[model samples]
Target: MSRPVSTYRVQLTPDFGFAEVAKIAPYLRDLGVSHVYLSPVLQAVPGSLHGYDVVDHSRIRQEFGGAQGFREMAGVLAAHDLAVVVDIVPNHMNTANAQFLSVLEEGAASPYADWFDIEWREGKVIVHRFADDLPQSEHYTVVDWREGPGYRRFFDVSSLIGLRVEDPAVFFATHEVIFWLLDEGLVEGLRIDHPDGLADPRRYLDMLRDRSGGVWTVVEKILIGDERLPDDWACDGTTGYDVLNRVNGLFVDPEGRQPLVALFTAMTGQDADYHAVMARSKRDVIDLFFRSEVERLARVAGASVQDLVDLLVEMPVYRAYVTPGEPVDPVARRIVESAAPNPEIARAVLYGSPEAVVRFQQTCGPVMAKGVEDTALYRWYPLACLNEVGGEPDRFGLSVEDFHDFCAGMRPFTMTTLSTHDTKRSEDVRARLQVLSELPGEWAEAVRGWSRQVSFDPHLDYLAWQTLMAAWPISAERFTDYLLKAAREAKTATSWIAQDHAYEEGLRAFAAKAVELPIGDFTALVDRHAVANSLGQKLVQLMMPGVPDVYQGNERTDFSLVDPDNRRPVSFPCAPNSAWDEAKLQVTTQALRLRRRLGPDAPYEPMAAEGEAAEHAIAFGRGRAVAVATRLPVRLAARGGWGATSLTLPHGSWRDLLTGGLYSGRTPLAHLLSRHPVALLERHDL
Candidate 1:
């Protein structure tokens, strides 16, 4: 039997920090939660909501009630028999911390000189890149070495300094904090952050797990397709972006590609393939930001301008993967061709010429190839690059057969997710894109009507559609304000680097249009498509041979965009009229109960069935218990699409555990389920 996930993702805060653990402990126990997964509770920026931005590694954040509170929280968890999994950022620390800031103040002379990925050559700290995406004023130089704390770089305007985790001292300093938490019995498991950015990912993870003393460990790794995590590392599984892509891909209609391609072609008039367009766009982003990075590297190396370019252009994907070692693979060249079909597009956007192309490929090939080469990489290691380049999207030329094969391999560690702190859009937003799967006539008519009324740039409109395609269930009221926040977060990129205004306008227009629909209509739309998508995800994720994950606030209803929006603190509705809360509680309770009843002896395998209607659903069976799920479309089905079809139950009379109703005829499972999610039928005898 698999170790089921009865998980709860909590954001530690002063309001509920260690103080509220006693109250929630009983609540989690009652809800049957086996583990409490928490955001980083270590010392962080003064009011840092998410703990990923660490400042002081030695102590717990005092804002969240500090060490005493952490101890109390641990005690409460132990009392409830729940495990505590802490999120740790092994990759970098916040520049705001005394240690990190002091490094900047003292320059190369600082005791912590080797504590970061800094290059000091010309009597000053060096910055690798400038904000090409941001407006360039003397005040806003490309590299801001004298910023808030250590040195400043992009990742939103936040003063987050990327550490040279490859450095031994840096690794040990970061580990010291984690070890403190572990040795104190404050944490039972760890979720490593951004494994992709690390130069030697395996070394860090191995060191962490060994010192963990047999604690459960999972990396926040992002493997795109066919990429497997290094098996030798001590890890339970990834925080599942690979499984997310595969599960999401299964829902996309392969037949819908033609119309999408045509629509995009008409909008852009660019002859490039979808993959080429995406590649060009990504190249544009990197190149737009490259000047400053090159300048900083030059300053650090004390080299001439051309020498800096030469090194960057020739630097291996990792310091370890340089030409002095292994043979490059043939498949890497094929992957490059697959991404950039037009050399002109590549030249115009990414690389300036054939030489630049070779250099860029040299860097990317080894980075991607290392995973295929079976290096000590975590699972989802390739996703760092893949996710940025639109990992396995239908638009990026991935086929259903290819996608399904990928899914088949992930059965053991499949982690299905929609929105995480990392994604550009939430699942709800992406569901809106599934509207592309509808009848072309209807989809075209709706877009045309909206276009005529909105009066926005077509390019911006396309961006809006893309955003909605990635996330949905957006709150229209907060739309424009949020876009401004998002843009502001990305520094001067909006005004300077790309000169793009259509994105901001288009997002606003889309939000406005969503609000035009009545609340009833909106709810109905959400339930029909969003709910079905959620259920389908559960079927694909849970039934598959992996531990399914539910991001912080996803269980009840997820109407969030990327990052800070998705990372909003979940507030349980106050008493009496908390129907939404109650309903979520019921669904979670039933799912866990069903999992328990299946027990250690339950037999699990994919189910096979025939019929056009069955194609709309995915079926899974374990011995006598069979699960049939409805993969409904974006629009509501007329009469709810062939209500419950008959399943020849084995022997004894079977009861619908969800509805307390009897199953006798060929009634639709949807009908039997009513509003309840899955139908649970058991034999009358056993």
Candidate 2:
């Protein structure tokens, strides 16, 4: 089975539709990507930039040029020898979808009633509304959407109703269109979206594999804390957060965790563990944002919803797959038994009915997404790189040995990425922040200076300062928008449902004041460090033992924050304006071409850097290729710039693929890395 040399991820909205993508094929081909990994391309809600809010499964998004356009784009890619791997959202669909509308209009009598995961006994498909204005319709009765199970939703997003993919009927219904595309050779592989939300992910993957004649597939799965993908799932691997987290961990200073944590603790006065904070956040979600889900779980367990919430708060991980008639999954049983058990809920969590298992399993994703990723990540400012979806912010950093262990463990053909549409910050933004871990003294001094100028909640102050620095060249408008969103997501002072006007206003005022401070103080410091880390990390990702993906526009510095912020249009005809950007593009293009030349199934080994400043670089070998990236440049430069350091290259007159220079035997690391801060060297043996 062949894997992609590199994948370019494009978000297909009305602005950049298939026609526009088709125009970029030659550029992608020249840049050396083997496939175009697209965001959800199905029909979505009107004018949705991010297509996760898919409304129709059977049709290509007409808003993004429809099926004809997709066919044209696919033809163009095929002509270039590029494959297509589409993101499929089988976990949920928009509430306004035709099938969902049918369920509302005809209630239980509708043929599509079983298509959704609705609690039929409730007799109401309650949709959560944030705005006061409600559209009165005869289709579905309007009720205050609170926590309880009338209809399953994706996280707290009421508009995205969950699908019952465990049902053979729903599975075939949702996937028929996708398979037809595969048959037509428009799509070569499938990347399943939110497979964790399914009742039985393994079974669904098996079915997809069988249906697609064993075509390549990857899931958008997050593996937390030493968790590996289950051996039984018949797919390639994840869409890359696992590799993202590990590879990114290499650049961070393992020494920064303590000081950052100390600062975070004193500022917030919250010394409780991260898991405890997560537990509290989960309970807060149940009471405030997700009352409907809690009520439904309560109904299934025959207990007060509070009891169910208490039980759920202690869950060790996301819900385990508990198909009825099969023995209870050990992971689920452990979570249930480990918690302070209420007999009624305990029974439901253990040897429960299909409904009970489902209700419990469904609640896990929302709580984890909202309570953990959205909430805790914002508040925990210990090494910002670790605060991402698959990262462990609480942990200091990953050691090279630990990374080697991971490389040895996971499947080699798995996809690896640094940035995606869902990333909280672009990889470059986080890479810049990683420099702060090494500059604790300077950072602390700057933080104290800003503290005198801007009055914010101490907790908010720490977060605000970091957020500003991470995305330094942000526009005033986008900066203000990001600050407000950050404050709410942190839930330290204000929340989405209820804004603390005084608190929010103060934070905004602080943002305005901070924005006036010249970015020069940090600009130079970040520039040197960012360049080293960016090139190093990018080289590591591409040459490492996995299918690396380049999130569109990441070939240059993308200092974007989350969501609408990260979704801005990338100006193409990718002209490298600055020397740094040119270096980034050159490194990216060279590594990608090298990956393509190296073929799919190459092996990996870590190489040692000897002599002074050795600690400030990471070097690895993949087949006939050797990738060397500089780290902690500020520290390395301060320590006399690789004074005596030399990276022992694998023997064979090695040619620099990027600059066409040659190196052999113990080459001085400084001489090799001075020009570009990173190098992709190919042995002439190839």
Candidate 3:
């Protein structure tokens, strides 16, 4: 199995395809990444911006230069000594898929009938096309759009139908192209998308491992707090939301929990408890979007629909990892019993019904995604940065001891990332937002003033204020799009399904006014500290015990927000336009190059600081390389700035990779970080 020393994520779209990737091969090599990680490369829905909605499994996307172009691109990357890691979406595919279309056209008689997870009744399939005038098919019936589809869909998205990958025939058919690429050595590794949606994630992974010769792979599994990946799964590890949340938590100030919560609750008139908000959001989604999934689970479990809904809403983690026909893992059993509405249901799920168990496990992921990440995160954000995917907003900060513990246990080959196309905000934006935790009073004042100038809906105004400050100097158009998306996702005044035009107009108008408001001074104030947090977190993430991934253009600074916003085209051969940009670029390049040199086998050793400000510093040694970063810069500055704080190096002359400064023995924190808030030091003797 091959593992990358580090990876650089590139979002491949029609505009930026294989040729574009080929053009960047030399640059990516120079950027010091062992692999170039790409988004989904298979054929997808037409004009798709992000290609997760794959339509064909047999061919490369023509819009992205097809098979020949991909071959050329791979060759170019190989010339540059850069391996490839392709993201494969095995959980679902676009409804436009030929196999799915065949099933629709021919129904039960189609050769691909078993390829999808469709419900059959009396040899006829029932589908909800969201239209009254359904297309006439002899073996299928179209019902109300709100009704459950005949087939399992991806997270309420009707267009992306689920794949029954647990079937041996379906698995082989869908993975043929991927296996061919793997055998040809065009792709060295794999990133499996949404393994939770599969009927049996562990079984699917075992098959994947056996077939692919156990090449390096990581699943895009979102692990909640203290939820470890199952030991049976045959992947390297998760795609690193666990690491992301921990690292992000290091910068948050725990002291800000109360004041921030108070301010948010007062302004929004909502409950201060994040879990309560989350539960309400879960129930709302169950009532609105996930009714189909709930109904199906209830039918399979032979339980009441309401009981299943209640249990799903109470589920703390994405899934319990329950495997049928085997003794339930104690941890998984505990999770289900705790979340189940009653003991009988828990027994039914854990011991009795295999169909019920599988359906329940599969449904948990979509419900959590829609309810928590999409809805609750948008609704009850005391500190917007903590509302990230797999993040708990109420859990404010992580102690240095805890973060070190997490890193100590991390699988070294698992990918760690800061920003991605799916991130709610860029790393830099979150860095900016983290500043609020240290200065809640000022942030509240700023929001109050902004609200007086232009207020939209109370439910969304606080988020808008935070967005404006974090993504400062944002264009009105971009901000409006984000705000609109936030509102709809929140499902408060307006939503994607039931658009309230009048409220939407108010939102747009408020966004326009918010952009024009005098918020630059406050943003500048936060940015002064944000620069420190940004550099510190970037350095820590890069040097941590995992394959760090630098999302495109994030090596410098990017304040993009959410999907289409985060997925904008990135320009290469770019130069730093600001001092902050220069510092971040230097930090990114130096750390990446150092990690590349150290390789993946370096051991991590935590280094403690000595003095009154010791808690503000996070230092770690990875063999000959050492990383030191400042956490909670606002509070650090307030406490008289690293006075008397010092770190004992490993008895060798060291050179600061960022500043090229020399150090030896015990180094004072003030002198070590005089030039920049973060330092990447390599032993000079080495």
lDDT of each: 0.52, 0.80, 0.90
Tell me which of candidates 1 and 3 scores higher on TM-score: 3
Q: After superposition on all CA atoms, what RMSD does each candidate show versus the true structure?
A: 7.9, 2.4, 1.3
Estimated TM-score for each candidate: 0.75, 0.94, 0.99
**Model 3 spans > 4 angstroms off:** 130-135
Using TM-score as the measure, the top candidate is: 3
By lDDT rank, best first, the candidates go 3, 2, 1
lDDT by residue (tens digit), candidate 2, 301-404 = 66777677887777756665677778876765666777635666777766766767767777777787787788878776656667888777877667777877
Q: Flag clash pairs in model 2.
A: 146-292, 147-291, 147-292, 147-293, 148-292, 148-293, 148-296, 149-296
Return whichever of 2 and 3 wins on lDDT. 3
Worst 10 residues of 2 by lDDT: 130-139
| Cα lDDT tens digits for candidate 1, 1-686 | 12435456677765657676556777666655566778888888777777777877778789887888778878878787776777888656765667644654566667877776443445466432433333232221234432322232323223566666666677767778678877877676777876655545666677776777767677776565565665555677777776666656655555666675566556545432533433333333334434444444334334354443433333223222111123333443334333443433323213233323323422333233322221111111111112322254333223434544554565343234555666655554444444345444455555555556654444334444344333434566555554545443332235333445766666566668744534333234444554555554544454444555556555555556655676776654312234443544455555545554565345554543334455555555555555555554542364455444434444556676555676653456456556644555544456
Worst 10 residues of 1 by lDDT: 376-385
lDDT of 2: 0.80
Winning candidate number (lDDT): 3
Model 1 C-alpha lDDT versus the unseen true structure: 0.52
Candidate 3 clash pair list:
none
Error of 2 at 90 (Å): 0.1
